[model samples]
Structure formats: structure tokens, C-alpha cells
Target: MAKKKSDGVNKSQAIRDYYAANPKAKPMEVAEAMKAQGINVTAQFVSTVKSNSKKSKTTRGRASAKKSVAKKPAKRATRASKATSEVSLDSLLNAKKLVEEMGGVEGARNALSVLEQLMD
Candidate 1:
């Protein structure tokens, strides 16, 4: 079967209607919808149209940053958070010193011996 070429209109009226009914939809979504409905618009064409529509709407509009304030945290864990899994030598040293001042070397050794157990 042969695919008929579009008549080379500036804007496909069907696509405009589809977008009007589904405002805020992505270009890919429109492309998929057109494909499923057996229309001939390409994904690139849909994307281009969507971008043009957005550009026209925002020609005199304020910058997007002025509309909303958003703070999105990084998705990956940081080095400091991973440090939680490893016991700090400084913490262990402080604990040992406290124990020894209260008693003696034996108390310090006891504290060091139980460091792993205490960390858990």
C-alpha cells in the first residue's frame, strides 16, 4: 500500500484540534496519538508544532523562572550521606579517651574492642 503525501499545508488542522483538546500534552504524546489514529504527521513535525505553539503563547510573557520557584534535590546520594555507613575514627577516639579518663588504659582498650559493636 502507498502512503499519500500531505498537501503541504502550513499547519495540519487535525493536529491543532488535537492539541487544543489536550493542552499541556507533550509532543511525543501527540505524535503517538496521531500514529494510532492513522494520521500522517511525523514526531518531528509534532514537536516542531508544539514548540511553535509554545513560542507564540510566550512571545510577550514573563520568564518561566518568574512564574514559579522550585527546589529539586539531586537524585543521587552525596559523599557525606554515604559516610554514615562507615564509623568515624574521631568518634571512636573521643569515646576511648572518655572511658580511659574515667578508669585507665584497660578501659580505653575495652572501649576500642567494643567500637564495632557500639557502632552497630
Candidate 2:
């Protein structure tokens, strides 16, 4: 078996570089330029590289959006923690007494739900 020739050249990078320098260049033009530079590539391969680069950029945009959304949850959690810290122990004890009077936590929640509906 014969080993495939390895010229140590990255054809995809070369194609991408050529396209970056010549943004309006066609796929065939990029292929021809790479062939001149000793990296044999087809126009189809160049087109594939361009399409893959565009997809990667779009995916990066979505990844950044997801990161921003993830940060929002952290901020909300911090605000919730601050709000919880602001609740006095007396208020918590009173709420506990109220829950016991209502018979249990579930009964208190049901009474609150009814109160909420009446308020609406």
C-alpha cells in the first residue's frame, strides 16, 4: 500500500485565507489561487469551507446569546437571595405560626390561593 502524499499544507485554511483577502472572489477563483500556492483544492471544497465558516459564525452568535441568557438567571438568583435576606426572622416566625393555625403548609398554600383568586 502506498502512503498518501502529505505536503503539510492546510488546504481549508489556505482557501479560507484566500477568501478572506478576496471577499468577492468566486469558489473557482479561490481553488485556482490555492492550486497556484501548491495546495490542490476543488471549487466544491472551497464552497464547503465557506459554508461551514458561515455556519460556525451563526452557531457562535447563538452560543453568545445563550451565554447572555444564562447570565440573566444568575442575576435573578442573586436578587432573589437579596430579597430572602431582607425577610426578618419575626416575619418568618409569624408565617410559621400562621401555617400551624391553617393546619399545615398545604392548607396555608390553599388559603393563599383562594385569597389570590378573590383579590383577582
Strongest candidate by lDDT: 2
Whole-model Cα lDDT per candidate?
0.66, 0.75
Model 2: CA > 4 A from native? 1-6, 57-120
lDDT of 2 by residue, 44-103 (tens): 999999988777454463244433433221111222255455865555766776686587
* Candidate 1 wrong stretches, greater than 4 Å: 1-11, 55-120
lDDT of 2 at 24: 97
Predicted model with the maximum TM-score: 2
With candidate 2 superimposed using the best TM-score fit, by how many Å does residue 30's alpha carbon deviate from the native? 0.5
Model 2's alpha-carbon lDDT is 0.75
Q: What's the CA RMSD of model 2 in angstroms?
A: 18.3
